[model samples]
Structures are given as structure tokens and as C-alpha cells.
Target: MKVIADENLALTDYFFADLAEIDYRAGRGIQAEDLTAANALLVRSVTKVTPALLEGSAVEFVGSATIGTDHIDLAGLATNHVEVTHAPGCNAQAVAEYVVTAILTLQPERVQAGTDFCLGIVGLGNVGSRLAQLAQRLGWRVIGTDPNVQLPEIENLSFAQLLAESDAISIHVPLTHTGQHATYHLFNTQTFEQMKPACLLINSARGEVVSEQALLNDIAKTQRPVVLDVFEHEPIISRNLLDHLALATPHIAGYSLEGKARGTQMVYQAFCQHFKREASKQFESQLADMPVLFNLKQPLSTQLLPLLPQLYNIRADDQALRAGLNKDGMVDAAHFDYLRKTYPLRREWAAYGDQSF
Candidate 1:
């Protein structure tokens, strides 16, 4: 069987080694012509899977090694009979670490995250739930609002109520445009008005969840701090928003080594099931070589603060992105994709030997 995979995927060679032929190509640079004779395709978020790209192709299956599917054309894929699968919750820990690190980075010395500190988590999905647990462990009172589910721990408050009560808000909702709880542009002028004047906003979720211009206007008026990992138009971010953000990254919040490996494994499993074949290797064996990073003997805070940078540093990513802007003060699409394509080796918190938490 012939399979075309994104070159940037973590373990394409190891996972698809047994296949008769496997072709790897740059995801964004992949064209419809490339898949004309392929039996399957594997990709990351960068590639848009649509009929236009697959209509005349022999491809029958598509697997995305990432959580978000907004980049994929689900309707078109279904109409074309191209089976699709994606890895959800694969990078939950990495993303949770990012949010926590951002909070600490924003106020490294001044922020005492005790019971008095209120953090509002906008979505209670995989990433949000993990973040809530981390925040609670740090002594923050966490309140959440997700109209979709009825979880006991998450206090079902209106989005407006959550904003008013939170000192900082982290958005983790999916991108949707039409519904009672449509999250597209959910954090607009009216929503910002209900927020605390000094609130810090963090968006590691889909970018369109917040209206770009509205967020800009709100930040200009309130002087609120914002940390943005995803943008409305990725690889073509707004310089105005870039300048205003406290932290800016090129959508690498979920690019931890462990996460990427797991994502590959998940999609590999789907590929195997689709073709009715056994997996060539075991995931646990693949991860055996990763080094352990933590010892539980020291004080939690003492160990965590120093260990944070070792796992991943929010500032380093921010600095890297800021350094790539051209003379016209804009990060071209190529440079933006290059940043993610060449991201450093970052491991998740769980990879450091503290799996019990």
C-alpha cells in the first residue's frame, strides 16, 4: 500500500516502515496532484483535507496527528468516502503545562496562586480539565463554564458570569459558528465589558473563538494582558495583535515530544484499523528511551519552578517568534510555518516521571 504522510510528523518512518511505499512531503506545500496515486494520507493541522485536494486522487483514508479538525473539511471528506481520524486529547498535558507556565511567566514573582486567586476555565474538555486540575493543585480556586456538559466539578455559570468572577480566563473551547453556545467570536465587546479590568486572557484553543479586532479593541481600552498561542489566520498573524500580546507563540502549545509521539501512535492505530492490519510496533516500547526528569523529594514549588523551563519555556517561544518578524514588522507565512516546523524538542510534564498527579 502506498501512503503519503506529512514530513513534519514525529515518527512517520517508524510507524509506516512496513508499508510497501511511504512518501513524506511538506504539509502546507502538499497539493492535490501529490495524492493522485496514493492509497492513504497522514497529516498535521497545516494541511487542509478537502475534496478539491482529494477528488481525483486514489486516497481512501486520511489521518490527522493533531487535536483540532477545524483545518479539515469533514463534510467534503465524507462525501468523497475518504475515511478520517484525528487524535483528541493527545496533547492535553502539554497544553495544560503551557497555560500554567504562561500564568507563572506573566507574574513570576508577584503572583501568589493561593485560594484567593480565581481562574476561570472557559471549556471543560481534555485540555481545560487538565489545566483545572493543575490550577487546583497550585491552590487556585477554579470555576468553569461549559454549557455542553454537566460535570459535577465544573460550576455551570454563564460565560459572562465566569468572566466577571475571574481574575484571569483561559479559553479552551472548540470553534463553532451557529448554535446556542456558538464559540466563534464568543469573547467580543459585550463579553469583554463583563470581564475584570485587570484580567489576563489566554487563548490556546482555536483562534476564531475570539474575534481578533474585538479583542484588540478590548485590550486597547482595558489594558488587559493576553497570551495567544493560536491566531485567527495562522501563518499570517496580525502585527497589531502580536505587539499587544504578553506572550505569542506559533501554535506550538501542543508540540511536546510525548504529545507528538502519542498523536502519531493514535493515528497509526486508526490507519491499522482502517486497513485491517496489525500495528508494526508497540507505543510503550517506543517511549522507553525517554529520560526521567523529576524526583519527588524536594518541595513542590522549589522543584516545579526550575523544572518548568527544562520541560518548556513560554518566553523562549515568544522571543523566537518576535525575532522572526521582517523589516515591515510582519511575520511572513513561510517564516511562521518554519518556526513550527523547526520547533525545539519539548517534553510533556508527565514525561518527567510524575504520572501519579
Candidate 2:
């Protein structure tokens, strides 16, 4: 079998090289012509997988290495008899840790997080649920809202209640436009008004889930700390927003080394299972020792402040993105894509010594 896959997918060759002939290409430019001779296609969030792309192709299966499927037309692919599989919750640990780090880093140093510090989570699925677990472990009361699920990490609350009660909030919902819990622009003027005046807001999930205009307006009024990893128009982010944000990253929240490896492995296993073949590659072999620079047993204030920055100075990502966007004589989109394509890989907290973090 010959499989056309995204060049960004980690371990694509390591996992599939022996099993099938591989054709790796940039995700954004992958076109219908590329799949004409392929038996399968593999993708990431940047690739749009629709029936039109599959119509005249020989591809019978499509695998997405990332957690989100917003770029794929699932129903259309299914209708066309093309099997599809995605790695869900693969980057949950990475994203969860990112939320924790971002929250503590963005909040005032005077504010010590103890039992009373409440973290409101919107959409308690993979990433949100993981964040809830981390918050409870780190001694933050977590209140969540997810209208779709009957049971969540904690008893679910109304979206308004979560906004009003949470000292800081993190968003982890999918972007939907028509459902009852349609998250497109979910954090608009009305919802933003419900939030605590000074509540910290973080969005590592989809960009459109929060209305950029409404957020810009609300933050202008309340002067709240907002850490954004994703933007509405990804490659074309706002210079104005960058100036005001506590931290801004180019959607690298889930780019941890372990996360990418796990995602690639998950989809590889699924592909092998579907084809009734044995999958020999294991992702753990790709993991290495995480450098522990600070004592975890030390006080959270001093230890974490030094430790998180050593492991991941999120501000560096902000600076890098800003520099890339403002480069002389280059398009913002090109710079943005180049930054992501060449992002320095980071390992998640799980990769640190087996001791409790």
C-alpha cells in the first residue's frame, strides 16, 4: 500500500515505512492530484479532507494524527466509503500542563493559589478534564461547564455560573456553529460580561471558539490577563492583540514531543488494526529524560516560577511569533507557518521523573 501523509506528522516514516510506501508532503498544499495513486492518506489539522479531495482518488482510508477533526469532512468521507480515524486525547497531557503553566504565569504573583483559587473550565472533554485533574491536584477548585455531557469532572454548572464564579477560566471546547452548544464565538460580549471583572482567561483550544472582537473589547474595559495560543485568523494574528496579551503562542500548546509521538502512534495503531496487521512501533521509545532543574517539593511560588520558565518560557514563544510576523518583506502567514513547522519540541511534565509533579 502507498500512503500520502503530512510531512509534519512525527514518526510517520518510523511507523509506516515498513508497512507501506510513503509520500510525505506539506499539509496545507496537499491537493487532489497528490492522492491519485495513493491507497491511503494521513493528515494533521492544517489539511482539509473533503469528498472533493477524495473523489477521483484511490485512497480508501484517511488517518489524522491530531486530536481535532474540524478540518476534515467526516460525514462526507464516510458517505464516499473512505474510512477515517483520528487520535483523540493524544495531546491532553501537554495541553493540560500548558493551561496550568499559563494560568499561574499570567496571574499576579501576589495571588497565591490555595484551596480558594477557583479555575473555571469550559468544555470538560479531553483537555478540559485533564486540566480539572491537574487543578484539583495543584489545589485549585475547578468548576466546569459542558452542556453536551451528562456527567463531567465535577458537577457541571451553567456557562454563566462558571464565568461569574471562576477566578480564572480556560477554554477547551471544539468549534461548532449550529449545535445547541455551538462554541463559535461562545465568548462574545454577553458571555464576557458575565465573567469576573479581573478573571484571567486562557484559550489553547480553537481560536474561533472565542470571539476576538468581543475579547479585545472586554479586555480593554477590564484589563484582564488573557493568554492566547490560538487566534481567529491563525497566520494573520492581530498586532494589537499581541501588545495586550499576557502571553501569545502560535497554537503550540499541544506541540509537546510526547504529544506528537503519541498522536502519531495512536493513528498508526488504528491504521494497522483496520488493515488486520500487527503494529510493531511503540512511541515510548521516542521519549527521553526530562531535565528537572528545580525541586518540585519546594514552594510553588519560588520553585514553579523558576522551573516552568526553565522547562518552557512561554514568553519566548510570544517573542518568536512577534518577530516572525513582523519580519521584513515577508507575509505573516508564511512566517507563521514556518514558525510552526520549525517549532522547538518540548516534553510534557509526564516525561519528568516518575515522582508526583
Candidate 3:
């Protein structure tokens, strides 16, 4: 079998040689002509798989090493008899850690003793649920809103209630088309108007799920801060929005080294299952190691913002990207690709050594 992998995917020679005949290219400029002879295509979020891109190709299987499949045209692939698979919840902890860090960073004042605060998790899926658990462990009152999950322990609340009552609200819902009860610009003008002026808003999930205009307007109206890891147009992030936000990242919330390894392993396992190959045993050993959270000798106080950044300095990555792009002009697609391809080594909390404080 011949396989073509997106350059951003970090599969080594050992991995590709073990699986199939592989051709890897870094640029996401994969034209149909490029894949005319390949049977399997491995891609990340950068490549858009559509009929126009693969109409005359011999590709049979496509796998995306990322949580969101918004970049993949699933229906079109189905119509063309090409099977597509994506790694869902592969970076749950990575995103959860980022959200937690953002919360701590934005609300340092709330770290004092005997201060009770509520964390509003907009969606209670893999990432949201994990985030809720972590928030509870950190002594925050956790409330979740997901019409799909009817758990007795997770207090289900209306979207409006979450916005109005939460001290910090973190969005984890997927972006869907209109008419869906779950989400589609769910955090628009009305919802933002209801939110507490002191509340800090976070969006690690899809960007368009929260209306950009509404978010800007809301930020203008309140002193409450907003932290964004994802944006509406992606690589073409809104300069106005970035300048206004307290913390802004280039949708790398789930791009930890550990997360990428997990995503690759997940897809590899699925491929082995589909082909009934003995590749499972080899794939098991290839599982990437997650970053260890250095154990603190003594339990630190609730003021974790400073400590957390030292442990996982997300801002450094953000600043580096901004600097590389000059932060003063439109970054071309090639520049964006370079930024992602040469991304910094962001490991999960579990990958660090013993903690100092």
C-alpha cells in the first residue's frame, strides 16, 4: 500500500517503513495530481479533503490526526468511496490543561482563601468533562451544560444561566450549522449580554461557535477578560480581536507533543484493525510519552498562575509566533505553515519531572 502523509504529522521513518510505502510532504498543497497513485492519505487539519481535491485520485483511506474534522469534507469523501477517520478526544487533557491555565492566569485575584467561584463548562464532552473534574479538584464550583448528557452528578443548566452566573465560563462546544439545539454561534449578543461583567470567557473549542462581532462587543462592554486558543478564520486570525483579548493563541490548545503522538497512535490502531495487520504490536510501543507534571514537595496555595506558567509556558509559544509573523501584518499561508511545522515542544503536564514548589 502507498501512503502520503501531511508534512506536519511527525511520523518517523521507523513508523512509515513499518506501515506501508510512504511519501511525506510538508506543504499542504496536495493537488489531485499528487495523490493519483496513493491508496492511503494521512493529513492534519491543514488539508481540506474535498471532491475537487480527490475526484480522480486512487486514494482509498484518509485519516486526520486531529480532534476536529471540520477541515475534512466527510460527505464528499463518502460519495467518492473514500473512507475517512479522525482522532476524537485524543488531546482532551492537553486542552483541559490549557483552559485551566487560562482560568488561573486571568483570575489571579480569585486565588485568595475562602473565595468560592463557579466554572461554567459549556459542553460536557471528553474535554469539558475532564476540565470540570480538574476544576472541581482545584475547589471551583463546576457547572456544565450539554443537552446530550443527562448525568445526575453534573448539574445541567441553561446557556443563559451559565453565562449570567459563572465567574469563569469556558466554551467546549463544537461548531455546527444553524437550527441545531446544541450550538451555532451560541455565545452571540444575547448570551454575552447576560454574562456577569466580572466573568472571564474562554474559547478553546471551535471559534465560529461564538460570534466574533458579539464577542468583541461583549468585551467592550465589560472589564471581564477573554482568552482565545481558537479563532473564527484560523491562520487568518482577526487582528482587532487579538489586540483586544487578554490571551490569544493560534488554535494550538490541543497541539501538545503528547497529544500529537496519541492522535497518531489512535489512527494507527484503527488502520491496523481495518487491515487486520500485525502492526498493532509495533504501534503500541510507538505511543508518544506525555510530559510529566513535576510533583511539588509541598502543596502550593491556590495561587497557581505563576507556578502553572513555569510548568507549561503557553504564552511563550504565542509570543514567538506573533514575533515571527511580525505581529504587524497579514501572515501568508506559507508563513502560517512554517509556524505550525516548526511549532515549539509543548508537552502535557504529565510529562514534566518533580515539581519545585
Task: List the candidates' TM-scores in order.
Answer: 0.94, 0.93, 0.88
Evaluate all candidate structures by whole-model CA lDDT and list the values in order. Answer: 0.84, 0.83, 0.74
Query: Residue 309 in model 2: shift from native, Å?
Result: 2.0
User: Looking at candidate 1, what is the lDDT of residue 254?
Assistant: 88
How many clashing residue pairs appear in each of the predictions shown? 0, 0, 10
**What RMSD, rounded to one decimal, does every model reach?**
1.9, 2.3, 3.3
* Top model number, lDDT: 1
lDDT at residue 292 of model 3 (Cα atoms):
56
Worst 10 residues of 1 by lDDT: 296-305
Which has the greatest TM-score?
1
- What digit string (tens of lDDT, one per residue) describes model 2 on residues 1-357? 889998888878788999999998888889999999998999888899999998799998899988889999999998999889999999998898788888766664523567688889898888888878777766668889888653444757988899889988899998888967788999999998998889989999899988888889998999989999998877688678787788888889999888898899998998998888898889888667666654566544445555676667787888888886463432287777777888887877656542333
- For candidate 3, lDDT tens digit of each residue in 1-357? 788888777553555567788888763687788888888888888788887887777787888888888778889889888888888888888898898877666666655422378888998988898887667656678888887764465667977787778888998877778555757788888888888887888998988888888888888878568888777766676457666788877677887776777777777767766667765434336545645544455333443555686667767766655654445655445655677787774766665653311
Q: Summarize candidate 1's per-residue lDDT along 145-232 as a digit string, tens digits.
A: 9887545765667777898899889999888889788989898888899999898899999888888888899889988999999888
Off by over 4 Å in 1: 109-111, 288-293, 297-299
